[model samples]
Structures are given as structure tokens and as C-alpha cells.
Target: MEVNNRYITITNHIQGSAKESDFELKVVPLRLSVEPGSSAVILKNLWVSIDPYQLNRMKRYSSSHKTVQPAVRITPGQPIDSPGVARVLVSDDPEFVKDDLVEGFVHWGEYTVVKGGMLRKLDPEIDLPLSYHAGVLGMSGLTAYAGLFEICKAKKGDKVFVSAACGSVGNLVGQYAKLSGCYVVGCAGSRDKVALLKEKLGFDDAFNYKEETDLNSALARYFPDGIDIYFDNVGGEMLEAAVANMNTCGRVAACGAIAEYSEGAKRAAPNMVDVIYKRIKIQGFLAIDHMSLHSDFLSTTTDYIHNGKIKVQEDISSGVESIPSAFIGLFRGDNIGKKIVKIADE
Candidate 1:
């Protein structure tokens, strides 16, 4: 049988903010049958993650060019791929079968053709919303788990701070710290998000970074004892400020720097002296490097969600057409928790 493909693709090279014009809805005529030398599977996509990390991919900008350098580049004519959730329609491999729900580097399409090591069957007993498997239970979940616990190596009663606290990965990081008995505080871009953090997400304290004229002062006020662990999501000034506020022997997990994603050049934020004075240890990690520990992440996060130790919020946008609006909204701090666009439901 043949498959049909209809998904979002980049219309052209982008200079600034991504517009709907930057993406075109295209249909690819798919042939489901794999060639004898090939092992490919057919996937009917359900939900897709609109992550900040994706913005880095849109640019014609590269090290050779003048705009944002590509940590991961997406060409102007290809489908936008991210960690997404899908149900298998057909497979030529022994590892997958029809009707298996999975997650991986799937394209922004109703149907996708992918090879091995890129799709995973989601656990059915999790009682999770389908989109949760794409965000919290998928990439975002592993990100927070690896960034906080694995790299940071947090301990009980430690003071932990998370930047961009209301988004997908930040929300989970704060919740995990709280569950692990850490004094968790988060700084967000707005007062509404601050309220959501403290009230809905149960952070120990939350501050609006936009309202704070001096980030250094805000950190001093919130972490009166100084931060012992910092889970960094938005770098630049926030990272510099967090460093200055670290207590002796503090740990910092350098995750994604969404603030610098669209910008060119590596500009160092002020305050490197703290690293020397406080004997701080900061480490940068790619979640891909920690894929070996995914089962452990799922196990721990699953138990927490099941037992109510953690709460996950998903900002769901229905239909594939909503991808551009949802993706653009992320830059404006429009999403509360994880932002996922539901393409279809099975």
C-alpha cells in the first residue's frame, strides 16, 4: 500500500522572526514499500513539539554567514523535524509494527518515513495525554532529568534555581527539584508566569525577570543563602547572574540557551569572578549524550506523575496548520508549559 504525506516545510531562508510565509504546507506522494536494501517505517504523526531549540535551525545563518550559527541547521525546503509522537502505520523492520505509538525525530507532517534508532514506542499504561509523550515524557522530560539530576548532581535541601521557569523543560526541572527536597526558585519573563510558577507549579519562590531591574538583586532576595545548584535554560545575562549568586562549590547544568539561539556571536555575560571565588562547577550537556539513561528518566518521571509528586502542563494547539502560530508564540513567552501541536488523534 502507498502512504500520503502532508506537512509543514520551510518556504525560504529566514533573516529575522519566522512568518507563515517561511513555512509552506506541502504534500509528498509517499510510497510505503521499502526497497530491498532499506528498512524504513511509516508513521502517522499525532503531536509535535514546538521547542526553542528549533529556532536555531531555521536560519540560513551559519558560521560562514552573518546570522545565527547552526548548532542544528534546517534547510529552507525541508520538513521541520523535532522530537515528535506518532503511531506506526507500517514497518519493514522487526523492531516496529503497525499501530505502535512512538516518539522520535519525526517531521512536521501527518505521515513520516523514518529509519531505525529514531522512533520509540510509547508506554501505554502511563495514563499520560498523547502530547505529554512528546513533551514531558519525551525530549523535554529527558532534558530536565539529565540537566538537573545527572549533570548537576543535586542533593537534598540544596537551593536550586531554574531560568525560563514556565516553559516545558523549566517547569519539570523546578518540580523535580521540589520533589527531591530542594529549595526551588524560578525566574520567568512575566508576572503571570511567576504566579503560575509559585501557585500552579509549586516552586518555593518565583520572580518576574522582566520586572527585576537588577537580576543580581533579585537573586540575592530569592536566594538569601545563595544558590547551590543552577539549571540553566536561558543563558546570557541570567547565566551570568546565576553564577554570581552561587554558593561555595555550587553546580550549574548548562542546558539550552534560547536567548542566544537567534543571536550571532558568543558574547560573554558579566561576572566570571564568581566561578573562581565560589569554586563553582558548570557543565554543558547534550541530552543526546545521555540517551542511555532514558529508561531511568522515564521510570523516575513516570513514578512521580503516577504518585502525584509531579504535575505536567501541556499547551496544546490542535491541527498541523497551527504549527507556525505555536512556534512563533514561543519566542514571545506565550506558552505556559509544554507547547505541542496536535496534528491528529488515534
Candidate 2:
């Protein structure tokens, strides 16, 4: 079967802040069936995650220190891919069957044919929404789990600080810290996100960073005794503040720097004096590097979801055409939680 598949692609390598104009939706002939005896599958994408990290991949090649190299760059006139949830339409792969739901790297399109590389079948019996696989049960969830447990080594009674608290990874990190009996505080860009962090996600406290005149003073106010664990997501001024206010031997899990993604690599210059004095340790990690812990993350997070210990919120936009706007919304802080684009219904 052949179908007209609509996919999103970059017009050119992006520069500075990304705009909806930077993307184009194109339709191409798509084969809906796998070739005979080939270990390939045809998927109908249901939910696609729009992440800030993707902005790094859209940049033109540069030797400058400011540019971020994505795992894969978006070539002109080619489909842009992201971690997504899909239903198998046709399969020659032994691990997947027709109608089976799966999660992996999928393009921002109505349909896609995947050959290989890390596709996992999703449990149809799971009570949560399939879209959750693109967010809380997916990359963002694993990122939080690995960063918090493996990197930060968070413990009970630790004072935790999470920047970008209402974001996909940040929200989960705060909730996980709370589950570990830590006092968690999160910072978001808006008042509503701040409210959601404290009220819905069960963070001990939350603040709107946009309203703060001085980030250092704000951190000092929130963590009078100093923060024991800092989950650094937005790594500009927030990182500087967190480092200055870190307690002795504090752990800093450097997950991402969304602030630098658009602002041309303006990284926070942390005070080396404070780092030396407090003996603070900062480590950067990628979720893919910690795949060994994926099973543990899925099992534990699924339990937390079922028991009402972890809550998920997704800002979903309908249709493949909405992908550009949905993605551009990330930098604007237009999303309250995980930003997703729904291409089809299960």
C-alpha cells in the first residue's frame, strides 16, 4: 500500500531563535508495507515529542564553541525525527507485529518506515495514555531517573533545586526527588507553571524565575541552608546562582542548557571559588549513555504513576502541521509541561 505522508523538515540550518518559518511540511509517497523478509516495520506515528535539545541539531556546521552538535543534524529537504509513539502498520521484524504499539526514534510525519536501532514494543495493557510513552515513560523520564539517581546520588532529606521545574525532565526530577523524601523546589518561567509544580507535581515549593529580579538572591531565599542537589536544566544565570548557593559536597546534574540553545552559547560562568570552597561536583550526562538503567526506570516510574505518586502533564497540539509551532513554543516557554504533537489517534 502506498500513501501520501506529510512530514516536517527544516528549510535551512537554523540560526539563533527558531521560528515556525524555519520548518516546512512536505508530502511524499510513503510505502505502508514492509518488503518481504526484510527486518523493517512501517509505523503510523501517534504522538511526537518536541524537545528543546532538537534545536542543537538544526544548526549549521560550525567550528565555533557556541554551536551545539545534535546527535543527528536535520539535512535540508529531509524529515526531522524525534522520539515518538507509533503503531505498527506492517512489520517484517520478529520483535514487532501489526497493530503493536512501539516507541523509538520516529520522524515528524504521518507514517514512517524504520529499519533498525532501538525500537521497543509498548505494553498495550498499560493503563496510562500511549502519549505518555513519548514523555514521562520515554526519554525525558529516563533522563530524570539517570541524572537524579546516578549522577546526583540524591538521598533522603537532601535539599533539591530543579531549574525548568515544569518542563518534561525537570518536573519528573522534582517529583522523583520528593519521592526520595527530599525537599524539592522548582523554578519555572511563568506563574502557572510554578503553581503546577507545587500543586500538581507535589514539589515542596516553586517559584517563577521570570519574576525574579535577582536569581542569586532568590536562590538564597529559597535555600537558606544551601542546596544539596541541583538539577541544572536551564544553565545560564540559574547555574551561577545554584553554584553560589550550593552546600558543601553538593552534586550538580547538568542535564541541559535550554537558555544557551537560542541565546548563542551564553553559558553561565560559575564561580570557581565557590566550587573549590564548597567542593561541589558537577557532571553532564546523556540519557542514551545510561540505557542500562532503562528497565529500572520504566518499572519504578510506572509504579509511581499507578500509585498517584507521579503526575504527568502534556501540552499537546493536534496534527503534523502543528509540529513547527509546537516546537517553536518550547523556547518561548509556551508549554506548561511536556510539549507533544499528535499526528493520529490510536
Candidate 3:
């Protein structure tokens, strides 16, 4: 059967801070059935993840596009691909069947047709909410898990500092570090977020970065002994301060650079002298690069959620049309945790 599928797309390549006007809602005819012998699977998207990284993809020219194959530039008027929790409507792949719940790279639309790799069926045993599969249990969770454990090699007694600690991946990194017997400190944009980080999320200490006049002073004050591990989500001056405050042989997992996403924003330039002398290991990583640890990440994160060892913070907006605004909110720090757009109810 044919249906009118409404999806979000850009009207032009965004140069700076994304406004709602830069995005346009486009509709097209979509077939719900897959041709026999075709590998395509039709899905009804339920929950779509709104991320800041998409801004880079929306730009006319982005260095991120050259970093990885998946970071391809998004063309105007094309449906943007994003991770979502969906229900399979029709499947030509043996691994999926009708009504199977799936979490994978789906378009920002009411429905999607995908083929080949990147799509996976959800585990039946995991009783968490479907939205979790789009956030903490999804790419965001894998990002946090891989960055902290694999990249930074977080260990017991380590003093860990997380920038943008109230964000999707940063918050999880903080909690995971704490669970690993590390002292965790997180920095957010507001006092309420700081309080939530400390009180609700079990962060050892939390501070509002926006309130600080000098980031170096703030980092030095927070990490009196110097930071052993730095999980950097916001780059720019935060990274510079973290590098200066890092202990000898400290490790830094460079995640997202939300600070440098806007037009004319200065890229991070940490002191090379400090880097050479301290032997700081700074590594940038992508979640897709660490799919080898997917099973372990899922199992461990699931256990954490079930045992109440981790608390999930999600800011959800309703409907597909809310996607652009939800995405724009990330740059503005308008979200507390993972910002998700609910496309349709199950």
C-alpha cells in the first residue's frame, strides 16, 4: 500500500546556528511493501534521536564529512537519517519480521525503508521503555560506554571530569565513572542541572560552567589534584582548560565538539607544551567505530538500569514536526539529557 510519508529536511545548507526556518517538512509517497527478494524493510518510526552532530551534517561544507563514511553531508530536501526505535511493517530480510521492534538508523519521518547493514532487531528480554532504545540503550549509551571504558580506560580512584555533563553521553559517562569507583565531577550550563547532576545522578560534584568567568580557574578549583580523565563533549576553551588542569599521563576522550558547531566558533587549541610534557592521550571517537563492544555495552547498561545503578535523563518532544525545534534546542542547552522526538505512539 502507498502512504504519504512526512519527513524533516533542510531547505539549504545551514552556515551557523540552525533556526527552525532552515528546516522544512516535506511529504512524499512511500510504499509499505518490499518487493519479493529485495532486502529492504519498511519501518514505522516511533522515537527519533535529536543530536547536535546533525548540524555539522547539515552544513554545506563540514570537516566532519571527511572523518567517516557515515558522517556524509546531508543534501537539502533529502530525508535525514537518524537513530530511532521503530516497528517493522514489512520485511524482506530474514532477520526481521512483521511487528518486530527495531532500533536502527531510520530517517526523520513517519516511516523508513532500509536495506543492508545498520538495522537490528531489539532484544525481547530487555523490558526497558522503547525510548531507552533510542537514547541511553542506543547510540548515546554505546558512545558513553566506549568512550569512557575503551578510549579513556577509566579506573578506580581516578578523578574524572565530564564537560556538558547534563547532556546525553556526558551524563552516562559520569555515572559509569562513578560506578567504576572513580570520583566524578560534571559541568553543566545551569544551577538546576548542576544540582540534578549531584543530587539525582550521583555525581560527586557538579558546577554550572556558564557561571564561571575563567574556565581554567574553574577546572583547577574542581580538580585540585588535577584531572586523571577528561571526557570532553564541549570543545573550545573547555578543552583547553581541561588539558591545562590534567595530571601527568592523563587521558582525554574527545567526544563531540558542540561548542565549535556554530559559525565562526573557534576550534579547540590545547597547549602543545602541556600535551607533550604531561603525555596526555587525547583521542576522538565515534560510536559506530566501536560496534565490537555492542553486546557488552548493552548487557552492562541493561544491568545498571535494572539495578538502579544508573539514572536516565531524557527530554522528549512530541510528534515528527517537533524534530527541528528539538534538534535546535541542543545547541541552546535547552535539553537536560537526551533530546528525543516521538513520531508516533505504539
Question: Per-prediction RMSD in angstroms?
Answer: 2.7, 2.1, 0.9
Per-residue error (Å), model 1, residue 2 = 4.5
Cα lDDT computed for each candidate against the true fold: 0.84, 0.90, 0.94
- Model 3 earns a TM-score of 0.99
Candidate 2 weakest ten by summed lDDT: 61-70
Worst 10 residues of 3 by lDDT: 63-72
TM-score of each: 0.93, 0.96, 0.99
Per-residue lDDT of candidate 1, residues 124-162 (tens digit): 887877788898899899989998888999779999999
lDDT of 2 by residue, 124-188 (tens): 67789999999999999999999999999989999999999888999999999999999999999
Overall local distance difference test of candidate 1: 0.84
Better of 1 and 2 by lDDT: 2
Predicted candidate 2, C-alpha RMSD: 2.1
Ranking by TM-score: 3, 2, 1
